[model samples]
Every structure is written in C-alpha cells, then in structure tokens.
Target: MKKKLSPIIAVSLFLAVISLLFPPSSMAGEERIQQELRDPNPTLNPLQKALGKKGYDRAMASGKYRYVGNTKCRLCHREFFVGRKKDPHVYTYERLVAIGYETNKRCLGCHTTGFGVPTGYESFEKTPKLVGVQCEGCHGPGSEHVRLHRDDASPFGMGIPRPRPQKPKGGKKEIKGGFLAGADNPRIIKRMCLSCHTKRWGRSFKRTPHAFQAAYDLYKTPLPGDEGDQ
Candidate 1:
C-alpha cells in the first residue's frame, strides 16, 4: 500500500528528471550566443570576444559603418524585403538551431548575418533581429549608405562613393575599389553562393526547375503575389 503522487507532483518530478538529462544550456529555447560570449575558449580567441565591445573595435574604428539589419533596408527596398522573407537564407539560423548547431562557433559564421563585423549579431539577446543571413550579409553594412541617403536623395550620392584613384607614381596602374553589388554577374554571384554552399555543406544544386539560382535571378521569376513580367 503506497500513496499515489498528485498530478502536479508527477509533472514536477518529470520535469526535474528531464532537466538533469539536459542542462539549461542544451534547452532549445535558450539563447546560447550569450553563454558562448561569457565562456570564451582560448583556442577560439576571435569568437570569445564576438559580443564584446573590443570585438567590433576595428570595424567601428573605420567610423563608416555598422549592420543596420534587414528591417532597416526594408524601408527602401520593399520588394526585396518581401522576397527575402521567403528565401531559405532568411531561416539559416532557425535551421542551425533545429540541428542543434546554433551554438557551434564554426557553423554560426555563415548562418548569422554579419557575425564578426562591427555592430553585427552580438547575442540573440542583444541583436535577435540581426540573426540569419540578412540584407547586410550580402549587400554589406548599410549604415553608411543609409546615412548618405537620409542626408540627400541623389542616385550618385546615395551609393558608396567610388574613392578617387591615387595617381601613378611609377607608371603602375591604379587599383580601384571592388564593385559592391556582384549579384548580377553569373561568375561573381556563384562565388558568393559558394561562400556557404561548399561540398562540406552537402549542397549540390543543379540548374533544374527546382534547382538553386542566385537570388537576383530568382527575383526575376514570377511568384504568386508578383505582377506580370516580374
């Protein structure tokens, strides 16, 4: 003759047992980014300070930029904003978390937007909005561009200004700033995609109807909400 446990007591005991098997850090809902910042691994020195002020010191030192998140970009590029919401890249972090690699420093580099860049994803706690491959991930940080546009509305002025080339000292060709938007170029765009979609990642995309294509090309394809010739 033993006394039966109450419903509440039974549930509490079950939860306690589960907690012992899986610590709070292993909990699916936990924001592991914060914990990783707290416990910096010596071998992974760069990541230990990922969320620290000094981590982004170099980026900020330039005083030209910071990651303003996709939402900020949405104010201007509404169509692209809508399109990106449906893109698989938007859910990169979610996919990582689903596979329990959300805390893996190596995986986070590609999954997150502006991982090590200034004003990039610090902790989900601090910059949850910046999570996943975002507009800044490809277009580069928008702070400088945004600042320029907010001050003026000229086409030439709104973009990152092509720096004046230095004069040739010894008849050598001057080096120019690299192009910003390479999404339009088939060759350059493939490199951008391969940054994350390497053989190790097991992403084997063919040119079939359902196969992968650059986002710019995919944007041209007709979709449900799009108008004719879109």
Candidate 2:
C-alpha cells in the first residue's frame, strides 16, 4: 500500500532524526568565546600594578656590574630552575633566529647578559654563561652580599629590598609573581622585570597603560598531564 523509500532517502532521514535529538555544539563554543572576550588576560593592568619606567632603567644598569655569569646568579636562584640545558633567557635567542638573526655581539647584547660587554669579551663562548637578563642581571651581582646575608654582616649593595611599611588592618597588597613576593630581596625581582622593558617606550605608554610583565620562571608553569593549581 506504501511506496518503498530509496536507500539514500533512508540515510538522509536517519541523519535528520539524529540532528534533532542531539544538541548543536555551536552554543557552547560561542559561550566560551564570549567569556574570553569579557576578560582576557585579567592579570594585566599596567596602571594598577606596573613596575613603571624609572624602575626598569635603574634595573638595566646592573648588567654593567662586575659581570658575574648566570651560573653565579643560579647559586641563589636554583630553586627556580627549569632543568633545561641552556640559560632560560637563551631561549629568546632562538626566537630571534626564526626572524633571521645571527648570534652576533649586537644581538647577544640584549639576548645574553654580557653581549655588549665593554671588556672586549662579547662572544657567547668567551662571555659569562649567564646570558640574557637574570635576577642579578638587573639586581647587580650578589657575590659580595650572599655571604654577608648568611653571616648577618654588613650589606653588600643598595639592591636589597627595603622592608615595606606594615599594612593597615583589613588592607591587603596584591603582589605579583610568587617568587617576586617570596624573594628575600624584592629588588632582584623588580630589576629582572626592568632589564628588557626599560627601552625607549615611556613616550608611547603615555597614551595607554602597558605595564611590564615577566614570564621567565618556567618552574611555576604547568607541565604535561599535571593539573595546574588555580
């Protein structure tokens, strides 16, 4: 009494039924996009918590100090190690290569610590192993002070972080970086953020706020198969 359906017609009808039964995935994807659009990179607020330009200028001057290599800085900063072969900052050099750069002294000057070194030792093999900006890279070398701190003797340089005034009751300071807050010396952390950003950038920032943000501490980042701490 009824006409038989073609095989193609049966498959199309089956797909239509399945589409009606199952919900479309576009709605959820759109919700995720809206959420990201609302507050992408919430942690960034230059006007609220920037280290400022003056802070970075003084920070870069430390590179011209006695020039203790990165290995020396690692002595105090071993806790933040990423366990990689090259220096954490050396990784930036690889990025430059992608855009056609050589490991020349001019390049390494900013890429590595002792790049534009005045001592006539600018080559990587010849320079200190601590290329790129480091804790001491901006905070000045600690060789004179590390022992002093341990011995409770006279302080070494002016780079030590002075004590902050006691916070008033119910008022909290939203500090940056766990290490920056945890450091016995905040100057080391501040200068670390300043070395690269202390360029001719202040004039442009007057129009809009863009604080310096540092992301070099690899240990703090999440690893494979590990759920990150939120």
Candidate 3:
C-alpha cells in the first residue's frame, strides 16, 4: 500500500508537534500575547466581589451566607470522617454541648469559615459528625467548583478523597514561604490556604503571594507510578 503525501502537510505536522513540545509563548508569536490581560477575578466571579475588603464584613455579620451543614459534606467525604472522631475539633464540639449552648444558634462558624478560628465545635450533638472540615468546608463553596467538575473535572485529588497526589500548577517557581518547584499557578494555591486559615469575612484571599509558580510545589500528591519525581 502506498500513501500520498504533500510537502505542505508534512511541514504543518512538524510545526504542530514542535509547538506542543515547546509551548512557551516566546516563539509562538503575538497570538499568545495579551496587551491587557483579563484579571483572574473577573467582575462576574462573585468570590471577588463578595469577599473584597470594602464592605464584605457587613454582609457576613447579618448572616447572608448559606449554612450547608457538615452532614451535607460527609455524604461523600467518609475518608476524612475517620480522623474527625479522634481529632480535638470534635472534642470542642462536645464541650459546647456540655455547657448548654443554644440549639438555634449558628455553630457552623466553628465548623467552617472564619479565620484564626481553631478547630472546635460549639455543639457536638447539634452538629453532624461527618460535617467538620469536609472538602467544601476548607475549599470554598462546592456550588461553582462542583458544577465546574461536570464539564472540566476539578477532582479533589487524583480521583480520590484524601491522600492527594502531586498537582503542581507551576513547573518550578519560588512561591510564598518556600520554593514550590512544581506549582503551575502558585498564586492561586496561596489564596486557597486562607479560605479557612485566616479568612476575613467574605474575603476569600487578600494576598496570594505565590499565585504563579511551578505545579510541583503547590501539592505533592503522588501519582501511582511517579516514584521518580518524589
């Protein structure tokens, strides 16, 4: 069998492969250039508007955010459940119950959100056992991230609950407190730490130092056959 080929076809294929191999914008021409880049936080994105410093505090004080209980989170995150029973955070919940805390009161504060708030519970019995620090508790609301998963697939880890594998956004960049050698978007990772770390009201992330870095440094989740990278 003989296959017909043209010189133009061969040259195009070679260029396509070369582009994929060296995806740096330096040689790809102005097609990849952006004179006025769109900010990561577009106006449409609610996280930027709601959590900003200007007036985010006022809305939080009035109980504007949703109260998705821990039970909702434990529906799928049974793995994290193993540690919660023993973690001190659960004990804090028990303490709150012993002291006679109000039932209608919002204990969700301790269970999720609020920066500087230690792992504790205002009530043990009142709050669901599976709810404390579930995936969404720390990783922002699941509404958008979940929906995005349908089309884009933003899994928590390598198709698993806990014990995440390495997902370095930046390839090799010096991020905030350390050098994240594999973080693709080091800056975004830094912003994520504070969804629970030191959150201020609706403020999601005030200062994401390593927003852009190598993918390796952000998360060190080991893929099944990636012993060499470690």
Q: What is residue 12's positional error in candidate 3, in angstroms?
A: 85
Task: Supply candidate 1's per-residue lDDT for 106.
Answer: 59
How much does candidate 1 score in TM-score? 0.53
Query: Which digits, one per residue and each the tens of the lDDT, describe model 2 over residues 87-160?
Result: 44446555545555435433444444434433322554665455455544433444433433333322332234
CA error at residue 70 for candidate 2, angstroms: 3.2
Could you arrange the candidates by lDDT from highest to lowest? 1, 2, 3
Q: For candidate 1, write residues 1-230 as lDDT tens digits.
A: 89899999999999999987765535343344444345443113122133234523544576766678877666654556544556667888998778687767655766887676657786678889988887666545667556644543334331455434333346222111111222333443354455555433323353344445543456453231243334
TM-score rank, highest first? Answer: 1, 2, 3
- Please give, for residues 5-101, the per-residue lDDT of candidate 3 as tens digits: 7889999999999887754433332232121123242222222233454433443443323334455445444334544554343443344355453
Per-model TM-score versus the true fold: 0.53, 0.38, 0.31
Better of 1 and 2 by TM-score: 1
Q: Is candidate 2 or candidate 3 better by TM-score?
A: 2
